[model samples]
Target: STIAERRPERIAGLVYLCALLQPSGATPADLHRHDPDSALVAAIEMAPDGSATSIRPDAAAELFYGDCRPEDVRTAIERLVPEPIGPAMSTIDTSAERWGSVPRAYVRCDRDRAIVPAEQDRMIAEVGVDVVVEMASSHSPFLSQPDALAAALVEIRDGTA
Candidate 1:
């Protein structure tokens, strides 16, 4: 059963699935042809300030914020925090009832190397969002193009988009 099927309650407001990589009925391995582990930064040690630190800074930059500047990448790495990547989060619910009734928008990052444009397109097509906004940014648009992201969010919030 899907969330919608189980809950059967309409969402009060809009939902934003930004830079989504995996669509319904797909996995991260489906997007990356090769071993996904190889692309991951091997040593993500925790800093004294409780922030995540990457030993392979270059690789992390390329993976997370490919469109960001060198200085921005350094700042992002320094401020990075640990995040959970659980199996349930990666899994997508294809049930129409749960997702179809909700108002949703997608923010596509064109230069996102982590998710890639093709995968993003697949999700947009499969899930079917109310609005589609494009940004010339990497995976981490919040760091690369925060202003644009904020504008899009505002538009969605105001229902003017």
Candidate 2:
């Protein structure tokens, strides 16, 4: 959404896949903090120097890959890295003239723990997407349900979603 807002002319549409969809002037941190159902919030560990944040490794499965295969979950956990705090803390500036003009779509993961279903619904209601494709998968649908995710993306691209 922020990217579309900043470069609306270059973007054809916006697709959020179990991703952050906060409103203008709202940061990712702000949204997570407000969402009581978000498992990620409890798992978040700030860096000692306050430069980055990472989830507790032990909480990875429940927070991110609850519906995923065991091996896939292990691999994803192995690949996890600390996310810089700057971007999550930065508030985006959006307007109807820019971000609102682009057709937006959301692929809501019903089984997502990081961003729970209630939070997903709240964001969709607030941001107003053109379409929403729900999946009975985890937050990492690309790993757990790639075919369905790809199909939804194709549908969004073809304007048939």
TM-score list, all predictions:
0.66, 0.95
lDDT digits (tens) for residues 48-148 of candidate 2: 99999999999998888887899999999999999999999899989999889999999999998899899899999987899999899988999988988
Worst 10-residue lDDT window, candidate 2? 32-41
Badly placed stretches (over 4 Å) of model 1 are 1-10, 13-18, 21-57, 79-85, 88-94
In terms of lDDT, the best-performing candidate is 2
lDDT of 1 at 129: 78
Which runs of model 2 end up more than 4 angstroms from their true locations?
Answer: none
lDDT of 1 by residue, 84-118 (tens): 44442365555665656666777887887666667
Q: What is the clash count for each candidate, in the order shown?
A: 0, 0
Give each prediction's root-mean-square deviation over alpha carbons. 5.5, 1.1
Q: TM-score winner among the candidates?
A: 2
